[model samples]
Target: MGKNQSSKIFSPELSCTARIFTLTPHFTQADHAIAGLAINHPQLVATSSARELGRHSDVSEASVIRFVQKLEYESLKDFRDALKKELVNSQTAGNSSVSTQPNTPTEALAQVVALCSQALQMLTTAIDIEELGRAADALEKSTCIHFFAAGGSIRVAQHAAFKLLRLGYPAYAQSEPFSQIAQASIVQSGSVAFGISFTGSTKSVVDALAAAKENGAIVICLTNFAGTQVTELSDIRLITPAPGGILAANSAQTRVAQFAILDALLTLITPRCEYVEK
Candidate 1:
């Protein structure tokens, strides 16, 4: 391809999920299968060979190669190298150290506080201020705003919605699965939907964001990882690094990081409120 054509075809800054989203229109059945593997099982892609990936994704080796090439990789090794780099970055960003056992409550509290502090530091480096500014602008201009979250994340969604409402924005938090989908389906232009998923694999949030995007809403995603299903559906993605492993799952550290993101977003939008400024 010519330089201009290659530039159009390749987006180095896009995550794996975003690449799949861009390629969806041109995908064959086999391509979809390969893309699914790339999006949902990136670890598998990073570790597996093209042939193995094909077998795992239920596609042929040629199909797997074609899929990688379509993503603008010169070869399977190139794709795997990129995926491995991304995985390493995510692992490093979300990595935290906390004592598995503590002799006293003081020790436990100290460990927790240390972990949370580290996670917040990671978040400071992970987030893009420019994208955050854009997200704030989107929320400020939105005629309506909706938050999609499930499980423990529902609390974060509720808090964000409440803050937005306090700022005089039309915002709602949809925690119920049915209600989330219903609201997402009807999201019109001039609306924004925020999906919060730490693991980035929450089916309810992903589905709702996808629906909202299809309905012309600007979908923003708050996720821990880049190459996730929710990120693929989002028009804007805000990532926060938190501790990984069992302790990290629904841990206080993750919640705190999420709250920090919410606070930053709210603070950025606060200036738009005449009453608040006055």
Candidate 2:
């Protein structure tokens, strides 16, 4: 066990897969194999004996025990118990339960599909129909729409903007903070400022939304967490189910949820919005 390793590495906010990825950089070369095995086959890690895991990962029995200890677990049994709990939590949290570890490509796809389905299922309830309707109403009346996002979320922002463009709305997506701030100054009462931040703490999106709000633009936000800076600025907030992450912003499942929200908006606005010159 590494003495320098902190128990704080395991945060409740992070999923089991997130914990493994975050700690992988700090692990020894042999521990890397254990990390992969644990992520793909958590049940095996929970049920297998130390000798069995060692044989499976091509490490010694002592190394297997050391790996568990390094994760701040007191004993192999404690680690196994924690793993069991995580597996159950994942299944309950709409993260899906696939008893068979994904060895084949098809099996791996089943897990992926299951998680995506879970995310979508969570969104059906997470979204407030009234809020969605208000957002659609705002978009229908807007002369223009501005999308604010940063990092990976920028792509999602761009996607939404392009969809609006085809629907005859003058829409633009800005990832660069300064450009967004500058652009926000030009937006007015008939404009829509749509912010995308899964974690809802993105300073770029928050700042843009704030600026647009001050300028009398209808502020809208798409986020996973509620009561965040971006959401606070929004007149219409679209919240989605959070797929836990250490990074916290955009997880794959959360992206699926966000996309579904955007798709729903497009559906609603299509009938309400009148075509304008694009």
Candidate 3:
């Protein structure tokens, strides 16, 4: 695409989610807060200033400039131009897709397969293998491992802890807010604390990681958003892509992916030992 076209694609008028996806890994704190605000109010974001956007989004002006430059733009002007193009393309794509009821079972199955396949592609694209390896190393070497998560992510945490424990590792799974914090406060250094959150924005989990850090434990995070607050506080962060459109998205599949990752780690860590012993 030409410079002008690219500029229009990333314009400030884009939807918050789109803006986030279009410039992720490259976003600074201010960019994310601004994108989050657009989720609540899109139009006002268009006319907002650095200071105004910062105040409204609760981020700093310096962060706004950092966010822009991170997206590979020469300046905020270039960033805005790129955003415009992204906005235009997204609208164009959405308008062209029409959901139609399938006339046959085979057709419906085909549609399901296509969507899952696409989701798998996105999940793989977002994962960082090196980060996963680091997390595995922490878990393997730790004297004690604590896993904490809430909501949909709790299941992933529980399952991972189970598999790891069965492989002869002492891993605890808890979602209780206070218990998580308490456990983190005491876990010794060289131990591991794993926190799971799809958005990587769960305050309690983040706090728990902080406590674990203060106690000298290595912290690892499994999340769908890279470079989020959770990642910032973690020793290593593993990410996966969101399935998109909250209502249509399948958290189950994401959990399954996280489980698969844990399974792989267990397999690598234990050769003679089985996950379950007689």
Candidate 4:
């Protein structure tokens, strides 16, 4: 395995990197160039030619072969076939993560099974063990943490605060709007602030993140959407796959994913600390 393909568990927080890690199970060193190209420019994955993908990723044709080998495919045709399957799996998994009822008994049962399966797939694909280590280290070394979430995001904020506190970290979640601003005002250097939103467009959350940044806190964003406003201000933006279908109400899935990352973070920062009492 290459230096990149270490056996680490990534937090769903490092969405982009985690996705890159998922490709490891399916790609090889030969496919790296094209795969990286496809991921960096998903637009190319659709209509672009292989030569175009090569040029865009700034890698050579030989590198594409190496990438395929890493993925463990025998030939280019095999790799492409598997790649198509992976895409289908990702899309299907996306739809299954959210449970939107179809107004029928049997349909609901099917949806429930699909939803559970999707959650497993998402959580599995989204974790990158090494990058998660980095995030954990950041959380551990920081002296304080300020959290912000609005509307749908508030749940994540609350859950993160709960975990951090239990881990004995100095963490606080902002509730009142002005309280967020006031807390941001006092964030010392070497602190971290988290903002959670699916769309990454919540104004209050954005403003609070800005304040945290101005006060010298490292801003971490938990959002699913790419190219959203909040990512512009965040030091790290963790992306979750958009929950679709009947499971839309299960924001708890997202929250649980966040907690998983927190668990990783806590583990790294305080490896010796006992998580459970005997």
lDDT of each: 0.77, 0.75, 0.65, 0.62
lDDT of 1 by residue, 1-278 (tens): 23355465555664454455445545788886786566556777889987799899888998987888778777888788887776665554433332246678987787667668766765664576677888999998899999999989999999999888878898999779999999998899889999999877899998899898888899898877656698778888887653353346588778998999898889888543556622
Off by over 4 Å in 2: 1-101, 245-248, 271-278
Judge candidate 2 against the unseen true structure and give its global Cα lDDT, from 0 to 1.
0.75
Candidates in order, TM-scores: namely 0.65, 0.63, 0.64, 0.60
Per-residue CA lDDT of model 4 for 139-240, tens digit only, reads 888898888887756766777777677767788997888898888888888999888876677788889899889989888877655455787788876655
Q: Candidates ranked by TM-score, best first?
A: 1, 3, 2, 4
| Tens-digit lDDT track of model 3 for 8-108 | 44444433343454455555556767655543343355457767767888888887766555444556665555545534443333311245566789876
The number of the candidate with the highest lDDT is 1
Off by over 4 Å in 4: 1-110, 243-253, 271-278
Provide the clash count, candidate 4.
Answer: 31
Lowest summed lDDT across 10 adjacent residues in model 1 is found at: 91-100
Tell me the deviation in Å of residue 267 in model 4: 4.0
lDDT of 2 by residue, 99-158 (tens): 446678976777777777766765664567788899999999898999988888889989
Query: Model 4 TM-score?
Result: 0.60
Model 3 off-target regions past 4 Å? 1-114, 245-250, 271-278
Candidate 3: 10-residue stretch with minimal lDDT: 89-98
Lowest lDDT sum, 10 consecutive residues, model 4, at 8-17
> If both were scored by lDDT, which would come out higher, candidate 1 or candidate 4?
1
